[model samples]
Target: MKEERLFSLRNPWFVVSAGGTALIAILSILVGFVWLPSVHSDFTANGLWGAICSAAGAPSSWYKGGDNVADAPPSNVVVLPPLGIARVNAVSSGRGATLATQRCSMCHGVQSPAGVTAPFLAGQYADVIYKELRDFQSGARQNAIMQPIIASLSDQDMHDVAEYYSSQSRVVQATAADGHDDSVARVLSMQGAPIRNIAPCAACHGVLDRKGAAPWLGGQSAPYLATQLRSFAAGNRHNDIDEQMRNVARQLRPEEIDSLAKYYAAQP
Candidate 1:
């Protein structure tokens, strides 16, 4: 009986037939709108093929703890507590910055005093950069394009890069939109709506002692921020843990996203 069961389960023909039948039954249970159940995420979630299959509406792929394949979420985004602005006076001159240029620029690449698609990493936060790298490495930031590049990095490498970028001085540059004074402009200026309750762009992003997963906003291209915030709000960027960023973006009045993007872009 066990051998017979194994034969049925292992047979490709039987498996495909059964899967199709089960899928039809599922549609019927949903009252026949050509419905398919959403893919159930699990600990064993693997590569593109597995994700594809599951998204095709496979059944019974879950384990008891949901998606805790190897570990749980961290209480903090970094290995060490962030050194606030006061501690900036204490670190060795240019040491962390040098390490970042060596290690991180391997993937991120250095600026040419020109321009490129890869992000310029100078002046970013240690914690925010660290979290992104960790998420990429741990499958939390799943992407067919990025997963492999980040998968091999050691934990220490991530920390070193974070510290390096955070220590650099921000450069100044302004965009054409910087000249505009529309409703979007008023919001970024912190003169409107929830901006009153939410705090200034400088408070979390433009300041020296900002905590949490916020990255630097200075000199970030307005076009990029505008697209990214919209992506998060619309669920196009769903790979983030807890979707904290998506939640943040969703709170924006449509104009607020536009305003914040223009605001950050105009920063030098």
Candidate 2:
């Protein structure tokens, strides 16, 4: 009778103990699988915590533009030449042309050979040209071909080359029809895909307003532009100031990329 009394399911102490164990099991399942994981997932998706963690882990000299602040050497500051193409002078152009023939014409040419795929430098903004050269020389940008070539150049040489290229007239190329909606590219260039957090290409690339060091994309080659966009999306091109290109490229679809490239290449 004593044993029966102690072990009975009807006893208040036995019932209380069983209830406590069940409660613990339920809480454990909720906390371990559901609550904790949900919290972590939310934190990751929001990126606030992740950014903080990344900042904490990064070196003190790391700049938001991916440059090492302490290691960066002084570069010649580029000032924009006056609005018209008339600012290109005979002496400067001659010097630049001579340098181009000696070094740059093999790859980037005023008139490239058939099937040559390098970006045409003609009519590009001088500031943009200078910045790219600087980035390449500093190792802030990596290009197997460009790095070696730029490494041999002095700051004055870069400026001279940039002057030559920016002085030449741009040739508008024929863009292949990819059968995608042209409006999509147009909208992205002018208005941007706000839903995807993309800024208008014109905001930087100088159709609407020129931003600092933004290149003129008006007559850029379609294939070259497309390749660059894809590279940025893939994280292969990391030299853009503030990860701007990376962020925009990552949000683009394949069709959008093709369309935008075509649109810009067709522009005069």
Candidate 3:
């Protein structure tokens, strides 16, 4: 003659089981929607790690937006015929010289002075110079300093400036005062760490072979070069075609970055 329950709603066992199931379901949803996506996004953004993981066929959520490797944007870099050393010298005496004097010399120096806050442009490849200018003007590259200066320049102006700089004599800074051997930097520059998926700096910078629109890094300013490497590593600079610099820079340790900058700065 006990009162019979209509349902299990009042049963302690049933309540516990139902509550546990609800908690499990909520956790599953969070893992699927929130946690998993965040992990995937981080993996994808880590350039060197992503490359390695991708080669190993690790499962990862697809990157959204236009960041997919297969759908990378067309390179804005243009390969121009090499501006011969003689030609650069000749053009530097003309309109190119005028432009450099008026605009570029403030930061880059007139004939490539050493130890400036900005990278020395003298003796840099004309195509490299022109491409950087174009990138700055087109908003492909973001720099608080360069963007405003390049905004008013025409394509022809860029070319003229490039020619002038390419022709000028290169200025070499004194070796790093720290007296470190810099063997690590030399190895990274000449022979990249293949295991880390870093390509040799020489490959693109013309120390070994010249590639399309890659600048000559030899004799660049150490402070400027270090700043740039750090910028690339931190993803603050995204102007490199195909994420080349960004990927390589991120893999470099702080000591390595300092060494590389010093090594290149002292080059002739």
Q: TM-score for each prediction?
A: 0.54, 0.65, 0.69
How much does candidate 3 score in TM-score?
0.69
Q: At residue 58, what lDDT does model 1 achieve?
A: 61
Off by over 4 Å in 1: 1-118, 178-183, 188-192, 195-203, 207-209, 238-243, 253-255
Candidate structures ordered by TM-score, highest first? 3, 2, 1
Q: Per-residue lDDT of 1-268 in model 3, one digit per residue for the tens?
A: 9764645888777788889999999997677556755765433334645645665778335667776454334347666667443344564547788988887788888885744577778887788888888888887777788888778987677778888888778876565533445788888889987756689999988868878888887777788889999988987777787788888998888888989988887777
lDDT of 2 by residue, 69-161 (tens): 342232343346442333446676787788888878887875432222667788788778878888889877678888887688877777777
* Per-candidate count of clashing residue pairs (backbone under 3 Å): 0, 0, 0
Q: Report the candidate with higher TM-score, 1 versus 3.
A: 3
Residues 1-268, candidate 1: write the lDDT tens digits.
3444544877888899889999988876564222222332221224444534545666335577856564334323343346443233325325445555555566454331122223556666667777777777776554575676556666665665666666666554445656545655545444323312234454545454454676776567677778777977876665444565565666566767877777666666
Best by lDDT: 3
Q: List the candidate 2 regions with Cα displacement exceeding 4 Å.
A: 1-89, 111-116, 175-181
Candidate 1 local accuracy as lDDT? Answer: 0.57
lDDT (CA) per prediction = 0.57, 0.72, 0.75
